[model samples]
Target: MKMISIGQLAKRTGASVRALRHYEQSGLLDAIRQDNGYRLFDESAVQFVERIRVLLRNGFTLDEIRPVASMLAPQPPDLRTVCADVIALYHDKLDELDQRIAALMEIRASAGARLAFLEEQRRRGGP
Candidate 1:
């Protein structure tokens, strides 16, 4: 099997070495430790790294991307191969985001109200 150094992988994939290391740390990618302590990776690592980048770009967090990232390793997912677990995950994420949005909207409204009250007090020269 063909293998390459992390630097080569990063260069070929247009990812920084730091980013590659981050991916490894996040468990989104893997590499082999050589005797000299250099990290090496299979040719397919390019595909996995690219998949991770695409998933992350689409707003999937590292934890959320793990399973989906491996679904079609070395290849991209296809609609035909879509499964229930992945679908459920998307639904869960959407639900989570909705809850967060509602909370943030409430905070925003509260802040706006306080700002308006302070501005009014300033205008009226009230203590």
Candidate 2:
């Protein structure tokens, strides 16, 4: 069993040291303290951190990933059920993103309209 130091793990995973510490603090990654008080991680941590990074890149919050992270633990309950729950979470996130896009579109349209009106007024010599 090869144990990697926190700095090595961060380098291998392309995550900043601060981010790795944040992940540990957020309960996303687990690390062990060496006798010398240095943080060490198992090789398995690389995969876990990669998964976390993927989720975050895809707009999943740490809160949203918590359940999924738990499911990835050594002994998880009912994988099928976990998959279903994760799918439901994705659906909810998708719905929220859709609503946000709709609102942004509305704002964009309003801004465009205002811009056009202002341009027309300027063309007509109005302040």
Task: Encode model 1's per-residue lDDT on 6-95: one tens digit a residue.
Answer: 999999888899999988888878889989988999999987788777766766788887777666365444444766777787798889
Each prediction's TM-score versus the true structure: 0.78, 0.87
Q: For each candidate, what is the lDDT? A: 0.83, 0.85
Number of the top TM-score candidate: 2
Candidate 1's C-alpha runs over 4 A off are 76-80
lDDT of 2 by residue, 14-60 (tens): 99999999999998898999789889998888878887888888899
Worst 10 residues of 2 by lDDT: 73-82
Name the lDDT value of residue 103 in candidate 2. 100
What is the RMSD of candidate 2? 3.0
Per-model C-alpha RMSD: 2.7, 3.0
Please give the TM-score that candidate 2 achieves against the real structure: 0.87
Q: Look at candidate 2 and give me any clashing residue pairs.
A: none
TM-score, cand. 1 vs. native: 0.78
